[model samples]
Target chain A: MTTNPNTSTLDYAAVKPNDTRAYSVRNILSHVFALVVAGFFLYAAYGKIGPVNARQFAVQIGNYKILDAAYSNIPAIILPFIEVYAALALLFPKTRKAGAILMAGMLLFFICAVFYSAIHLGLSIDCGCTGKGGSKAGWGVIARNTGLLIATGLSVWLYQCGPCAPKTSVDS
Target chain B: MKHIFGVIVILIVSVITGVAAKAMWYDTWSPTKAAPPQKMAWVKQQTSDAIAKTGADRNQPGTSGDASEKVTDNDAEVSDSSGATDASLTADAAVSNDEPEFSGGFPVAKLDMVVDHLINGTAHFVDAREEYEFDDGHLKGAHLLPSSAIYENIENLMAVGVLPGPGKPIIVYCGGGSCEASHNVAKVMAEFDYQNIYIYVNGWEEVMAEPDRFAGQTE
Candidate 1:
């Protein structure tokens, strides 16, 4: 199993099956990150879809006081589906980046809304982030969203570095 | 560019699926139609008509049992601030001597009484908060009667057979801390001729404070 002295170090590492393919740390980490994010978003969407209460969800949206009551219904109707689509898009290799982008954008919006409603307005209302029964939108929720944003960024970055990414490297 | 295309595709799919899902379970949110922009006078007329219907249809009482237990002194001479103070309506109301006397148009109930009503189904608990807050946790048998679109919400309420016209002790509560949602909802209830409406001022906050006792009471 020893590398021949004749082979150069760069070529030797490249030839190691463990190093490049089956055991690539970058690949596993990327998928793991994506899996976590996808699982989370899917779970969130499930909560919304399970109850399937658009009007109630719209009221939840209105609680943020960000959107006018009239405007809240459309988002409430569509947001859960968006989460599901984004999570699916992320799991697939072709649309992973796009999903990540969508997820990151949503997380950013949620963070701001939670901050404004829970922290700024001091409303003791539920966040409704993960559908019904979500906790109040407060500092703790802000921290959680921020962490999710970081994870989202890392998922895409790591995915790009993984073997699934289109490669332009030349072998020695 | 591909990423953008992929995102657009995802968005389109989401919109389509969302619409389908909304259609599939339209009943769950059909009540929210009240929030849309509607002719005010028309809505008011519809609401008044509904209220009149409710007012006219108040003959039957709740099924005999604990329902009759919450008898209110409809003719009680309560002060403005303590609307039901001297009424001593229910055993739960008289259970505690430390209960806060009302400070508003309606009588205020203590957490114990609210919890008791919840357990016994002695009163129809109407949650005055938004649907989302009600979803988080609310007293069992609580009606989500937010005051925003009272006309439509009440119609929805009536559709569900929850006619609150001068019958059971209607306990209305909201997110406590200086929140006026409960009071607003109570006023609307009064407009519908709902006598014996009690306000649980420290509603959600109090219920949330004692996680253990009220834990099982939430929907």
Candidate 2:
């Protein structure tokens, strides 16, 4: 990628694509956020599938009253695979875009699930957000997800548009 | 791409399904209904002993400085058998009593003393370990309640209906001094009003070392 020095107005213009500038910074933030989400999901899924079992997870979801009678065993058996996939997907550059979008969507769904459970269903259960550290469903979860959503959205979008073109010339 | 979508779909469906199943399985989160309180008999014996001691003291020459009333209030505070207070009050008080009970500061007990209390029916010693670790032969009577479930199922202790209230003494020990779960649990128990809480720093490693004294085995 190349950029003309005299005509560009973007602040990131000074940053070169391969010059250890905005590109690296952006990549670092994006990967970090992706890994964070992956870590959270992996921990949650592990709790459900490994030791704590999925009953607790189902109980939180049951607060929504959507599926009614088949909540526990389903999450217990399925979440580990999805979490592992999400974690792995973020590592591959090709898959990173889709992974970010998927992560954003998952977080959005969780926020909605918690909201619905709190207001519409009127049941209060821990969000199991922090794995065993006791992160419950509340404004904190929403706020945290909203921040991640913005960061992740920006990362995925910027990466798609391509980093600012190198300014020192391709030969340099 | 197709596989990823399939995996997401399955994940969502399963999470939703699991939620529904848990709601139907248990009507309430309390678990005391499954195991009756083990303290009632002990309470009864203590009450009778208290009454006998008080009676003997009252009959003595210069010991009539409000014996019965003080004894009555103390006994009633614990197990008022006469229903002067609601059951919830007693239950709440009992729950509070289970808080770590320490007097005159954090008195460090000897390892043998800790094990003796655990084995001689002094405290409900619990081992906060993973299921596999617990199944591979934990301290004989140690209850296997993992740290992960401690917060989620603490209300289950309320369900047990026999907690020693907010000031009870409880000793929490994990795998070893390096394990954080036991100390973490001890801290939470303190928050819940467990007054005399102690973290067995050496935990199982220390306990297992002297099996004859702690694990009921003559090594």
Candidate 3:
């Protein structure tokens, strides 16, 4: 019997007949990974969106010295909300791929920025990842962003190949 | 590709909505404020008190001499030993004399000059350290204006006399020579057209190392 893959439950027997249980476990793990990433984005956005924090975040962005004040204000105003949107998108199955892509892009940007600041510039300012009182930017922040990038990539792959994919009967 | 476009659209909408909400609720969107008019009454009082304390201390034999005399003496010594290890401690803990000019165009002051200003009460001290750090200890009479809150509280700082005005000499400092909080706060003050801003590069660590020279210690 064919089961609709998009309905949330994976017909694991049809998808991977030899290892239905393993397929099911993999599917569950993928969902968990997506949820965790979504939660992370949400938490990051939460710290950065308030009136006071948004301004502080702007200042932190200014410290990078890559962008002038006019250009810096644009990201300072939009980045947190984009983070919020990405988190919401990740929570919904239909939008998971888009969310994962956006998150990966953001993580890549962050990793690059952290690497540049820590290695090239030798700046010891706060990473400003989680707004005010953020920990200093260093190799550790790069490591964390790299890990999150890996998780996001995995989630995207799982969504494309697992339950979120279209289903077809094994006999067909 | 379509999905990516959709995501971009959503993000643009979200930013607009979020900014609109901020504008509605917060009353002002700009992070900075115009420089307030100069107010010197409270500054005069604080300066007088600081001067009196310095004068009294100078009378006690071991204290530094009068403000002008000390400034001249310290200036000579600072110019001579500008980059040398401070005589106060181990070589490892030497105060850094390489005070980089702040991007905001404010002048950089060495530890001795800062201490001189503190003694003479010619400059108002603004501590840009975090609240807990300020609580632990700070330079005597230093206003706790953490960098995070400087823009929001600029007016409050002015009202409370922590910032006397644009014309008053304001010395901003933080944890150490490398700490950016002092520079950041100084930048904001400069943006507000503060005329005589100075960054105390060696900051609280150097000052606290010799507590006898400076006054307030709340650790």
Candidate 4:
């Protein structure tokens, strides 16, 4: 194989295209994780955005007591769309990093909310995660959010470290 | 930066599409228009049939009308006609000329008033808690009419013969104070023209807190 005279041996090996099986695996894993997370968000958004369910979703948000009744409607209105957009972004290779980051941030926010509801607020209301009649907000909900966060983090890492990373002039 | 902008554009488009779809398809898209009111006469007819059924059951041979009273030794304070009158008067006075001063646009029932209805067997109790919560514990003779179920299949409730006719007073409750399930259920009942709907604001939690007051009747 012809190599660039100016390139160091280690640098050439690191960017070599032949040993791409690991990259393929990492890419596949990232896509799988992204799809799973995207499906979850889409399903959740569907459950929450329905006409009848949306009102209930708003009420559930109000029950958290984190926002006033007037402001509770805002999240009820916008969050579902945001979820849909994030899920869509995750489906495409070019936008996967942005999607992963957004999903991770959302999962972290949800974890904090669930944790507060379980520990600090001492509330026993529905978590409203799926937009329908959800189970009670408690440790289980926090754990679920934590799992999603970890998955999103993995997706971000794989996107950054695997074949999806941007090519530099040295690779060419 | 380009990806960020792309995400923002996607978000905006998603929201617009969602809003448009909701507006076009959902009858409940607008807050004010959700849950259109039912005819008062239809509600009256339903209530009358229920009352007639109750009357017929009371007259049946060997069936004791006082069975409920015997089951609970706690004599409700508002059982007497005079006490009922006073309670009704208090509730009426609380109402203004405009919107009713009740939580769910229905009359508010004090615990004693609810107990009186329970003893007399004149009211139907609807537990608005989830099925699992209802299964855990609930008032004796209470029907599980969860808010979510009602939203999904209101006809199922009517078909099941659980919802008493308009003539029978209905008492709805959830977990307890600040719990919106009961209120939401009550609103739906009111829209159906159930005129004598009442909300027990301090619901299962309060009843469980003072089991003696309920005469240990909770199941």
- Highest lDDT model number: 1
**What TM-score does each of the candidates earn?**
0.57, 0.42, 0.63, 0.74
Candidate 2 stretches with Cα past 4 Å from truth are A1-20, A130-133, A166-172, B1-219
Off by over 4 Å in 3: A1-20, A164-172, B26-112, B119-124, B127-169, B174-180, B187-196, B201-219
DockQ, structure candidate 4: 0.38
Provide a comma-separated list of chain B TM-scores, one per candidate.
0.58, 0.47, 0.57, 0.64
Native A-B contact fraction in model 1: 0.44
- Lowest lDDT 10-residue stretch of candidate 3 chain B: B84-93
Model 1 Cα lDDT, one tens digit per residue, A1-172: 3444454233444456654663367767777888888998998787666333455466667767788767987898889899999998888868889999899999999998888887888876767777654365688888988888888888888767666322334436
A1-172 per-residue lDDT for model 2 (tens digits): 4455564433344443355566667677766766676676666666665323544444334434455535434644455555556556655566766566566677788788777764555433356554453454567778887887776676566565445454344432
Model 3 chain A: weakest 10-residue lDDT segment is A163-172
Identify the runs in model 1 with alpha carbons over 4 angstroms from their true place: A1-18, A21-23, A50-52, A164-172, B27-171, B176-219
lDDT against the true structure, per candidate, is: 0.68, 0.51, 0.65, 0.66
Residue B127 accuracy (lDDT) in model 1 = 85
The DockQ of each candidate is 0.26, 0.07, 0.24, 0.38
Question: Which numbered prediction scores highest in TM-score against the true structure?
Answer: 4
DockQ result, candidate 1? 0.26
| Full ranking by DockQ | 4, 1, 3, 2
lDDT of 3 by residue, B13-125 (tens): 78787778577744464433234323444554554564455345334454333433443333212111112111111111223334344433455667666777677776778
**In candidate 4, residue B80 scores what lDDT?**
26
lDDT of 1 at B110: 73
* lDDT per residue as tens, model 3, A1-172: 3566566555756656645555566677778888888898889888777666677777777665567745776687788888988878877878887788889889999988878866787754667787765376788889888988888887767655664433444552
Model 4 chain A, poorest ten-residue lDDT window? A163-172
For candidate 2, give the lDDT. 0.51
